[model samples]
Target: MSKGISGGCKCGAVRYRGELSDISSFRCYCRDCQQLTGTGHSEMFPLVAETFQLEGPSREYQMAGGSGQPTWSSFCSTCGSPLTRRSERMEHCLYVHASSLDEPEKHKPSRILYADAAQPWDKPNLDE
Candidate 1:
């Protein structure tokens, strides 16, 4: 059986539901990710196009990434919780923060990206 993912803003003003397949998760340690996640790494799950859908309007901001690609960061305008990131090269895909899932335990990062961009002080524990 395939169960979909459901989550929303802390204030419940924004809700989302989607069915994502071919899951691929990773932690990115680029400057943008560190700043956005407020941590050493930003965890995400690769989202296949057409598999994800937005139920309500989400606030989006344009930013630059380590990949030198235009990044669009989106979040709940009401609560300001980070929602997703869309990149130009990955237009067919959307990346959602794993922590944003209703059941975060079910989503785990599988790899690390931009390892060269990682700061000297940020050491992520990869062993589970």
Candidate 2:
């Protein structure tokens, strides 16, 4: 059996597990990500939606994406730790915040999204 990736929220109110997807992990610098993470960008890793499992108290916040599609941010209702991001544009996969992973060091972002929207102080290392 394949080992599942697992992690949870800060307050232990939310947890999730899933099998990794073929989609490459990426860093998003969009305004929504910045505001959600309270930083310049967000690191995301993808998991197969069909294999994703989430438990405990969580809430979702929806907003219009840069693509003008509805996007949702799921987080722990107790600790408010951002957990995942979902969008109408890509429903086949679940994008998890890399920092929310049990092994965040395993996250390797291969690409950058919304680089043009990236802040000056947090310039993306495009050469990666």
**Candidate number of the best TM-score:** 2
> In candidate 2, what are the lDDT values of residues 12-59, reduced to their tens digit?
888999999888889999889999999999999899999999999999
Q: Each model's RMSD to truth, in Å?
A: 2.0, 1.9
Lowest summed lDDT window (length 10), candidate 1: 1-10
Candidate 2 stretches with Cα past 4 Å from truth are 1-3, 126-128
Query: Native-vs-model 1 lDDT?
Result: 0.78
lDDT of 1 by residue, 1-128 (tens): 24577776667777766776575678888788888878888888766767787767679999776677798988988778888888897878788888787777887677888888888887765675
Clashing pairs in 2: none
Cα distance off (Å), candidate 2, residue 93 = 0.5
Q: Could you tell me which residue pairs clash in candidate 1? A: none
Model 2 accuracy (lDDT, Cα)? 0.91
Superposed model 1: Cα runs more than 4 Å off: 1-3
